[model samples]
Structures are given as C-alpha cells and as structure tokens.
Target: MSINARLFYVYRIVSRMYFHLSVLFVYFFTLDLPVWKIELLLGVYAIVLLLTSKLNAAMLTRMPHKQVIALGELIKAGGLAALIANEHLGILLVGQILSGLGYSLAQGTDSSLLRTIMPDMQAYKKAESGSSSYTFASFLLSGIIGSIIFNYSHEYAFWCSIGANAIAITAVLLIREPAHTNTQQEARGAKPTETSAQKFWKLYYSITRAFAMATFVGFLPYYFFTQTQVSLNIFGLILSLFTLLGFISARFIVRAGNVYGFAKIAATSALLCTASMALLGSSSYLPFGIVALAVLGLASGGVRPLTLSNLNMGEWTPTQRTALLSSMEQSFGLWNAILLIAGGFAIDSIGFQWLMLILAVVYVVLMTVGYWLYHIHTAQPTAAAEQIQ
Candidate 1:
C-alpha cells in the first residue's frame, strides 16, 4: 500500500471505532426519555443521513476533496461533544443530524481521495482489499473496549468517541491530494453525468444486495440454534469461522479482479451469493450449514470489493464519482431501514426457513434483472454510447 492508502486504512479503523458507539451512547444516555421520543430522534437521524449524502455529493463537486474530508470529521466531533455537554433529547437530535452529515461527507470524500491518489486498478485493489479485515478488527476491538468503558460511565464512551474523531481529523489533514488528480480532471474536461437509468440500476443493485446480505447476517445465528439445534459453543465457532473466511476471501479480491474484471466478478459473486443463501435455507445437516455459511461469507466479502471497484471504473469526474458512491451508500441506508422493519415481520410471522427462502428468491430475481440490464447496456456499442451521451 502507498503512504496515503496506509493512512486511510488507519483512518477507517479509528473512525469505525468511534461510530460503533454512537448509537449506543444515545440509547444509554437517553434512558430516561420516552421510547417513542428516542425512536423519533433516530428516525430523524436516518432522514438526515440520507439527505446529507446527496448534499455531500454537491459539496465534493464544488470544493476541494481534502477540505471536505476535514469539514466532515469536524462536524462529527462537534456532534459527540454536544452529547457530552447536554443529554437533552433536542440536543441529541441536532447532534445526530450533524453526525450523519459528517459521516456522509467523510465517507464519499475519503473514497474519492483514495482513487485520486492511487488511480491504477491494481494499486487501488491492493490498497483496499483488506478493508473487511480492518473493519472486523476494529469492530471487535471497539466492542470490547467500548463496552467496558460504557459500563463504568456512559459519558466515558462519548468522550472516547470524541477523542477518536479528533485523532481521525488529524489523520485526514495528513492526506495530500495527488497532483495527477488535477491532470485527470483537466483531461476529462467537464464531468460526465450518469443517466437516470444508470443511477436507478446502480441504486437498485445496491439496495437488493444489501437487503439480502443483511438478512443473511441477521438471521443466520437464530436459525442455526433454533432449527439445527446446534450448541452455542458450536454456533460461536461457526461465526468466528465465517469472519475468518471473509477475511481470507478479501485477501484474494485484487487477484480475482485482475483475472475476471470487476463486473464479471460482481455478477459471479451475486450468483454464488444466491446459491449460498439457498443452500443455507434448504440444508438440514450441520456440516452443510457450516459450509453454506462459509460460502456466504466468501461471496459477501468478494462482492463488496468487486462491486466497489466496478463502480469506480467509470470515467466520471472525481466529484461525480464520489457523489454517485454516496448515492449508492444512501440506497443501502434506505434498504437497511426497510429491512429492519420487514425482517422482523417476516421472521415472526413466517419463520426463519421461510424467510431465508424468500430472500433467496429475492436474490435470484435481483441478480437476474441486474445482470440482464448490465448485459443489455454493455452488449451493444450503440447502447453504451447512448448511455454516456
């Protein structure tokens, strides 16, 4: 990894640590508030995040990407500081809005900056292929440390978050924009914009894939114990294996991307993801279930890097690219919200087997439709030109 990429990896680890506690802090700190009020604040937070993702896109277009990164981190820090100062519901709501906006901006800008610094496909892949591993590590570390700290005092969690963000902000300042970024911008001239059809399909793919992935993660443990009657010890082992498999799969993404290309890899992973879900749903044997979960983990990890690399392969300007990525992230946010509500109903009313089966079918349909559109657009030269035009 290049210097910038290494710095970015560090930034992600720290940033994830801080964010992992954000919602927990709110819940514990606002324990005296009515449940409905707390829910409303969270709802507002969702809306703000979705809206600000789009706004962040515009900001990226007009301002320096590095400046946007700094601004975003500062906003997030300000939000954490708000909670420390006051525990009022209204204050928390405002803080959530700032936090959401900051995250949207920081995330998109960070990706854009990485692309700017490491423009080569192989270089980018090398830099980012271990992202899932980093996330898993940060998640584990933060979960342990944050829990212990929160147990002592809820305010301590908030303070730690604020400190983490401060460190993240300093890291952001160290990221220097590559000189080639300006050259590329000048060469491309005006930014090429995405057609509505292109945007719609990208968002559709993100939403459906995210929903399926979330369902798999959320339901797997419950299904395993309830249906398979697996021991908790074995279940924990399976989960750990899943994480390890995911990390191992991530290590191979760049090589896989080089051989098959991003779109093809995405299409293949989506198919395998469908099969894995189906297998998990249908298999009654414990060994089969274990293999299926491992396949799910592998496919999930591969799909993320491949899809992101594919998305970043386009010729759009940096701002446009980051904006679209932000939009895709928002699509995920929307899907998660929908799934949280719908998933509960599906699980309670239909049962886990039926729910997985339903999701498997959903994945099949989504992958079919997505790849169909993908082929239709790319298969003909004229169709491709019309899309760009």
Candidate 2:
C-alpha cells in the first residue's frame, strides 16, 4: 500500500475510534439532563456543522488540504478536552460546537485528497472502500472497548478519544500534499460538469439517508437501555455486531454496485432502511430489535460507498468536489438538527416508538419523492446527446 493509503487507514481507524468513544460516553455524561436538553446538544452540533460547511466551501480553495485536515483534528481534540474538563451542560455545548466545526473541515477532504493523489479512479474507489471498512472496524472495536472503559472510568474513555485524535493529527502531518490539478482548473474558470438539478438530487438523497441513519443510531442506545432488557455489555456487543456488518458491507458494496447497478442498490438500501425503522419501532423484543439494527447496519454501510462512488463519477474540479461534498454534509446537518430538536420534543411527548414510526413514514415519503425527481431529471438527455439524436 502507498503511504497515503496506509496513513489514511490509520486515520480512519483512530478518528472513528474517537467518534465511537465520544458517542458512547456522551449519553451517560449528560444523563442527568432532560432528553430534549441532551438532544439539543447534538442539534447545536449539527447547526454548527451546517454553518461551518458553508465556510469551509468558501475557504477550501485558499487552504492547503493537509493543513485544513490537521487543524480540524486539533480542534476536535480541543473539543474533547472541553468535554472531559467539565460535565456542565454549557461546557458540553462548547465542546460540541468545536467538534462540529472540526469535523466539517475534515469530513470530505480525505476523498478529495485521495482522488488527487491516485491516478486511477478504480484504485481510488478501492482505497476509499478500504478506508471505510477500516472506519467500521474501529467503530466495532471502540464501541465494545469504550463501553468497557467507560464502565470502569469515564475519564479514561474521554482520554482515549483525545489520544486517538492526536494520533490522527500526526498522521495528517506525514501526508505529502498532492498537485492541485482540479484547483488549477477552477482557477482558470473551468465550469463543473454537474448540473444544478444533479446537485439538488444529490443533496436530497444525502439528507434523507443521513437523517434516517443518524436518528436511528443516535437514539439506539437509549432505546436499548430503556425499552429492552439488554445489559450495558450486551448493548456494546450489539453495537459491535452492527459495525461488524458495516465493515463487511463496505468492502463489497462497490463491487455489488458495479455488477447490479448503483440505482438498484441505492433503492434497495432505502427500502431496507425503511423496513428496519418500522421493525424497530413495532416491537421491543430483543431479537426483533437486533434484527432491525442488523438490517440498518447493512443498509447504512452499503449506501455510503455507493453514494461516494456516484459523487466521484463526473468530471469535477477539486474545489467543486469539496464544495459539493460539503454541501451534502451541510444538508445532513440541517435535517439532522431539525430532527434532533423536533424528535426530542416528540420523544418527550409521543415516546421513542411512536416517534420512530412517524420517522419511518416520513422517510418512505421523502425517499420515494427524491427518487422520482432524480429519475425525471436523469431521464432527460444532455444537450449534446439531444443534438446527436
């Protein structure tokens, strides 16, 4: 493997370890707060991500990718620092804001960097899939290990997250900067090949899928803790199973897409997401919920590589690619913010099961309409094709 690929693998492992650890611990740390207040923390985090993504899009052209990524890791570490320093709600909010900003900066740049350095698109896709698998592998390890660590000492778990960020930052430092061919094209005022309608559809798909996945994952711990008889260790193992499937799925989803077609894979993933949510909401039985989560894990893992492959399909300048990816991330943040805030209140009123069922219905409508619009837009031939016809 190339140095970049190896470093990227390390980065994925450590960064996702940080993420999984934080997510697992954050719930218990804020357990004293009302659920809405807890959810508000994530809502605020999403809002910051949405706003910062816009800022990153504007600044990406001016900044070195490595520098931006390194700075993001540092800021994320600082955010973890803030979280561990105090358990106060106000401090936690500050931590989340900083974390959101950092995450936004680093989110899509890795793939951009990978694309820049790797000459072959297929190679890049392989590397991307490999990195994603590494991420989920880390997720699996961290979820179980972090839970165990948290059970012993919350301070240790948070420290491990900070350490992971530190390692990631070091990895960023070692990465060699690539020639910015796409940025140079942008500098010369070359227009992107992607149309506005295409961008809209991309954002639409991103928002719907992200909202469903985020909502499901975010509240899953609470669901298992409150609604089921599962123990903390068992819950951790369940999460391990989830990420294990995700790891497996990410490895093959791209190949599956190539064979069966991306549209079919995407559509099937959406239906799976819908069914998983409905199944989860319908029954509190452990087996049923586990089955639902497994389905969700499969859907979530497969769709991500598919989406990334789709996004990387067209001829796009580096700046445009980064900006477009940022926009997708921004869309996720916007909808997730709305979901977290509204769903918090909804959870307080209607409870988790009812809220989940409502969300499942909403997802079905949103995805169906999104796919319909996408079909309409895509079915129309390009100007060149029309002229040839």
Candidate 3:
C-alpha cells in the first residue's frame, strides 16, 4: 500500500484519541438545555449529519477531495471552540450541524482515497481488515480512557477529544494523493462506467435502509432511561459497556458475514431483533429486561458493520460510498431526535413497557422491509442477467 493508504489506516488508530476527547461532550451538550431539549438538539444534529453526507459526496465527485475535507475539518475545529464560548443551546446546535459536514468529508474521502491507492478490490478488502479491527479495539480503549478522564476531571476529558481531532486534521492534511487517481481519470472514457447519478441513488438506498435498521438499534438509550432509570453516572457506564460489548461482538459479526454472506447475516440479525423485541414487550421482570436489552446489543453490533461496510456494493468508489454512509448517519441523528423524543413522551403518557410493544412491532415491520428491499435489490441484477441471456 502507498504512504497515503498507510495514513488512512494510521488515522483509524489516531481516532481512538478523538473518542477519548468526546467523553466530555456530554457536559456541554446538556449544559443549558433540559434533557428533553438535549434530545431534540441531537435529533436536529442528526439531520445535519445526513445533509453533510450529501454535500461531501457531491464535492468528492466534482472537486478535489483533500481540500474539501480539510476545509470541513477547519470549520469543525472552529465550531467546537465557538461552542466552548457561546454555550447557548442555539449556538451548540449550529456547531453540531457543521460538525456533521466534518464527519461526512472524513469518512467518504478517506475510504475513497485508499481505494485509489489499492485499486484491486480483493487487495483492498484484505488491507482494510487490520485498520477495521484496530479501530474497533480503539472504541473500548477510548471508553476506558474516557471514564478515567471523567473520574478525574470532565473538562480535561473533553480537551482530550479536541487534541485528538486536531491530530486527525493534521494527519489528513499530510496525506499525498495517489498517482493512480490521475491515471484512472485519463483512462475513464476508455469504457463508460456507471454514472455518478445512478451511483448516488444506489448510495441513497443502501444507506437509508441501513438507517432504518438503526431505528431499532438505538433502543439502548431508551432502554436505559426507561427500564433502569439509573443516574447519569450509571447510565454512562451502561452505555459504555454496551459499546464495548458491541465492539467485541463486531469482530465475530464480520466473520459471520464473510462465511455466510452479508444478506444471510443481516437476515439472521433481523431475526434476533424480532425475538428480542418480543421478549422486551412481554417480559415484566427486570432480569428479563436486561436480557432483552443485551440481545438488542448483540443484534445491533452484529448487523451495523455488516450493512455499513458493504454499503458501497452498488458501484461507487469506497470514498463515495462512505460519504453516502455518513449521509445515512446524519439521517440517523434526525431520526433519533424524533423517535427518542417520541419514545420519551410515550413513556410518560403510556406505560414504558407498552412503548416497547410498539417498538417491537416496528422492529418486525422494519425486518420485513429489509427482506423486501434485499429482494428488490437482488431482483434487479437477476432480471438484468436474464435479459442478457
């Protein structure tokens, strides 16, 4: 792999540092806003992330990738500093909105750039394994480090995230574009490839479907808030534990996908989700609640990467696909804002367990949607092949 490609891998390692820094964001996130208000902000923030994903995709296809990403990073850094000073709910919301752009740029372009460095599809997959695993491990490590930082000093913990992001920004700037990019561009017209427009729609479908899957996955927070009703400290610990477990479980999920293929793995995951939801709906005992929620963690961890990693399967370069994923993530924030608040309200108005019943039904419906879309996606190819015959 080229130096730039190595940087892409190394950048993943450095991202652990960014996670460490985010430990303190919860402080600023809730500073002036009520918990309900905070949830609302998060909802809006998610929508912006989706929009950012769209813009980043456009820029990558139409402009210089490196420069565009750098500009977004610069804006992010500035936005963070502004939040530190402004600290108003409105100001904080704006900062988060712009930060979505930063996320989109980094995710989309980084993977795309690495593809340029490693053009052979098989070779690229093999190479991605190392970075992907390290990044996964880093999540647990960051949570540990974040906990330690929070225990000692919340302010310092947040600063750690800032420093890590700063390093990421610098590292991104140093990466040199691959020589292959120009060669590929010159050879582009040799045979017409898929148009960017078709690629974009494919990207949209893959991501939105993934996002739909996530609607069920995000039950962690609701479960914590409603079922346990623990203090923020305990809530954080549980959430971290969930992520840590999810991180550990993700490796096995990857293998399962490789062995059985992503479609089957996804189907199996949906099955787990349906079962878990049913358990949550009917189980009155706290232990049953815990078990049901853990099942959710297992299902979510297993499926998230399966869907996210392969999202580019349609035709876009890794970068464009990643950007599409980022857009999907942004949509996630939006969906979260609406769904979470609704869940909270429903909990207050109706019984908490009843809300689970509704979500359970939603889960089953989403799985059906997943199955339908998979067939739809597969049918197109099969139909095309039949026509070719």
Per-residue CA lDDT of model 2 for 1-389, tens digit only, reads 88877887787678788534424424543457777787787788788888888565555667767677778888888887887778788898999999889898888876676676675888888888878877888878877787677767666777887888889889877877775333543645754666534554465457655655565556676677666746667877886767877788888888887788666676777787888889878987788888888888887776556667766444676677777777788888888888888887778688777887988898888777765665466645454222211
In model 2, which runs have C-alpha deviations exceeding 4 angstroms?
A: 19-31, 179-193, 196-205, 377-389
> Alpha-carbon error at 112 in model 2, in Å?
0.6
Provide the TM-score for each candidate, comma-separated: 0.70, 0.91, 0.75
Model 3: per-residue Cα lDDT over 65-121, one tens digit each:
666666666666655555555667778778666655566566546556555566676
Model 3 regions lying over 4 Å from their true place: 16-32, 61-63, 179-234, 275-294, 302-305, 308-334, 373-389
Which is the leading candidate under TM-score?
2
Candidate 1 per-residue lDDT over residues 79-198, each given as its tens digit? 777766677777877887887778877876777777777778666666666764575556445544654565467677677777778777777678777542344345345656555345
Which residue ranges in model 1 land beyond 4 Å of their true spot?
1-3, 18-49, 77-99, 130-133, 144-162, 178-205, 216-243, 260-264, 275-295, 312-315, 377-389
State model 2's lDDT.
Answer: 0.73
Clashing residue pairs in candidate 2 are none
Instruction: Rank the models by TM-score, top first.
Output: 2, 3, 1
